[model samples]
Target: MTLILALDFGGTKLAAAVTQLGSREWLRYERRLSPIDGNATTDLAIMRSLIYSLLQDATPDAIGVSFGGPVDFTTGTVRLSHHVPGWENLPLKDLLEKEFAISAIVDNDANVAALGEHRFGAGEGYDSLFYITISTGVGGGWIINGQPWRGNAGMAGEIGHIVVNPAGPVCLCGKQGCVERLASGPYMAQDAKEYLFKPANQLQGQQLRSLVNDNLDLITGQIISQAATQGDELAIKILQSGAWALGVGIGNVANLINPQRFILGGSVTKAGEIWWNTVQKTARETALPEIDFEIVSAALGDDAPLWGAVALAESALISK
Candidate 1:
């Protein structure tokens, strides 16, 4: 049996799996959360442990890696990770090939997830689709004409950095009102914490404050969502603003590419009906009536990247 190994180096987690080529199920799988203070070395070590545990003594025909950062697909070199340090200019593909003495392929997680969706998940029957993840950070990937579309320098599908509210707060990328600045989970949590810090806002976020037990630092996107569900005006406002930002980005992307579907994944996507409704409503309002498209949840959830890694491995084997 032809064996394939897949790895996902997510911003907050690491996963490794082994499967047979052409099989839809994994033979062995393992996942672990990334350390809060982890860097590239720590993350790599964790991944190596998972890989060894999954492989046992078997060898795979090809290995595929999905990295949560910008990568030069042709060279498999990671440019950098916005959420993790020490990944700059790393030749990940070459390192993997040398360590395992086998062919390995790597790409940006978003791009690989898009391919996974196209081949095995929500985008399976669709030739053109866009996949967006809205958890620790926001990112996008494109499937155009039934194939992954990484534009020049493999930097395409960066919907997160798209300017949605040019007057909004600054982002880590030094841009104001970028989609990720407003819509990402961490940013939402940050915004909530900042708002609750003011005495003037004290009367507004009662439920939000209660959720975090008056500890502003304890606020998170999930906490905000919980508060919103409990009728906290401040939390509702913040969540809706994020949804609106993502909606604007999605609408603009739809107009630009006119994809058949938009597949959304990640933890933030589970923020309940309020978030989902706002996203759908805002997207519809932003897009022209002439445009027609559908927005749907990703079928593979957090496993999308790993499955995409499998697809990458399959491609590598075919190439050889």
Candidate 2:
């Protein structure tokens, strides 16, 4: 069995994996990370060390990298990333190849995950699928015929920055009312904080004071989800509001692509059916009557990016 080394670079953590080139069997390795602080050289060195530590026994035939940012497919360079400071315009593919002395391929992390899911997970048997992640931010990827549909410049899956409410909230992208500002984890957290400050509402008064009196930093998206799980109406309302924004985003994608399935994944998705229900309701309401499909959860969970990197590497190896 051929072995492939896969690395997933994200804002909050780095995940490495060793797996059979064409199979799902693998060992997982993950490390929590602090912000990279825009030190490109240091960040690259750290990534190299982590890769060496994880795959010391055997040199992977090809190294697969899925980076959390826009990448120029023609140049194999990362354009920019909001979370990881030092990742901007980095030549990730060339760097990995030189560092590991092996073939390497790099692409958007979300795109890679969509590829992985299309081939081996919930998207199997479907000709096309849309993978959307609701987490620190909203992102999406498209897999067409089991392959990622990277646009001409390789910046295809940037649906997150789409303007939803022109006057809603300011996004890091210097845009107002992007989908992410209304639906992402931070947005949910911000919404929860605002909800806590509303005037003496019956549902928020006691809980809000309790949450505040304890010196809690502030209401978080997770806290709101926890409250919702405990049947708090206010929390449920927040969830619904976030979910509706997510649905509008999905609906826009759906009308444009009309994919066979829309796979929702990421950390915030842990809110479970509460999030799904609202997304479904809004998506259906906003969708064109002529098109229909399933809106479902991603099956690969958090490990999707790792597996995706492996899969992309394996495919690159085969094509070579």
Candidate 3:
């Protein structure tokens, strides 16, 4: 039986799985968290351990990799990672091929996840869609005419970097009011932390403080969601702000691409009805009346990248 290996170098975690050709289920799987201060060397060591554990005496016929950063798709070289250091211009595809003596395919995590959703999850049966993941960061992938479209430089689906509020807070990318600056988990937490200390906003964030036991450092996107559910004004405002930013970005994407659907995934998407409702309503309001689209959750959840890697590996086999 032909075997394919899939790997995900997610920012916070690493996952590896092996599956037989044409199988919908993994033959073996392994995953672990990346170290708090992990660089490419450490992350790679963890991934190699997982792969060794999963492969044992068996050899994979092909391999696919999903990296949580920009990648040169044609060369499978990782450009860089915002969260983890030491991953610049890493020749991942060549390394994998040399290590395993087989062909390997690699791409940015967002693009891989889009391929996953398009082939077997939310975007299945849809020829055109945008897959956005709002987690540690916000990113997007595209499907045009039933195929993944990685534009020149493999930077096409960068909705997170899209400017929404020019006067808003500056992002790590040095842009003010970019979608990721306002909507990503760390940014939301940072905003909440800063807002709570403002004297004029004293009346707000009471519930948020109570939830975190007055420890603002404990705030997170999920905590903000929980506080919002419990009627915390500050938390509600922050989440709504994030949702609004994402919604506006989505609206602009809709006007530009007019995709049939927008598939959202990642941790922030778990913020419940309020977040979802806000995004839906705001996007509708921001878009032109003529543009129509559906926003839905990704069906694969955390496993989308892994499954997408399978599709990528399969593509490599077909090309061979």
Candidate 4:
């Protein structure tokens, strides 16, 4: 069957899938995540294996890859990721096409995810929308007129790097007080660890941990959510604090572009109303009330970026 080969290169995981052009049920592929300290070479090798394994029989025509960091669209070079090491300006598209002997397209992961969500998920039917992913780090994507907008230099929609506080914690981008350093999942855990500091337990040392015995290893974003669910005061306060920062970011974006809808995604969105409630309150206080807009969680889960990869391939093919 005619299909698209898609890949999502994320900080924590990599996923590849074969999907029909216009349907969700046609999705199928193998997925894997990077082990701690996994480098660029390891990720590329894993991707190559995944493509071969999933498309052994499908014989897809083109390959699409959505990378999790700044990508040069003209040259398809990845400009490093905060979580992944050794990914500085790597020529991913050329390498992929050379290896697989198929046309390949690559772009920013969040931009691709925005396309996917707009076309098939929460942002569907909206002509103008913004997508923000609050995970280990914040990432953003913009969709205008039913397509992704990769601005000149292909660094558009990097909302996470927007400065929220001049004196806040430093971001991986080497800047202090960027939105990501304030509102991302890791940032939330960091705040929790600082506020609820116990000499015996410290969570920031580990990436993600369970919440038990004040082991610090158990105080992950997930554990924080669970605690918040159970009305844990510390957990609720941390999320609320992050939400205020996010609301400022979102409001800032809203006041600037005022898109039709602002869609929220990433692991943090699983907090449901906990995050959104604060976002709404803060955005209203900070943004222009007259600007009509709606906030919603992205419908696509982990699959958002994969569909976006397909969109990248499709866009490239059509443009060609």
Candidate with top lDDT is 3
lDDT for 28 (candidate 2): 44
Stretches off by above 4 angstroms in model 2 are: 35-39, 195-213
Kindly indicate the candidate among 1 and 3 with the higher lDDT: 3
The all-Cα superposition gives candidate 2 an RMSD in Å to the true structure of: 2.3
* Order of candidate numbers by lDDT, starting with the best: 3, 1, 4, 2
The 10-residue segment of model 3 with minimum total lDDT is 195-204
Measured against the true structure, the TM-scores of the candidates, in listed sequence, are 0.98, 0.91, 0.98, 0.92
In terms of lDDT, which candidate is stronger, 3 or 4? 3
Compose the digit string of candidate 1's lDDT tens values, residues 169-278.
99989999999999988899999888888888778799988887888999989999999999999899999999999999999998889999999998999898999999
Worst 10 residues of 4 by lDDT: 202-211
Q: What's the lDDT of the predicted structure labeled candidate 4? A: 0.82
Estimate, for each residue in 57-101, the C-alpha lDDT of model 2 and write its tens digit: 777888778777777865678887777666677888887788778
Lowest lDDT 10-residue stretch of candidate 1: 195-204
What tens-digit string does per-residue lDDT give for candidate 4 at 1-320?
55789999999999999987666754677889787889999988898888888877667767888898889988888888767898998999999888767788998888989998987899989999999898887888999887788888888888888887888888877898888887788778777777656656553333223346646645777777777877777777778878888888888889999899988889988875786899888987878978888888889888889888887777766776
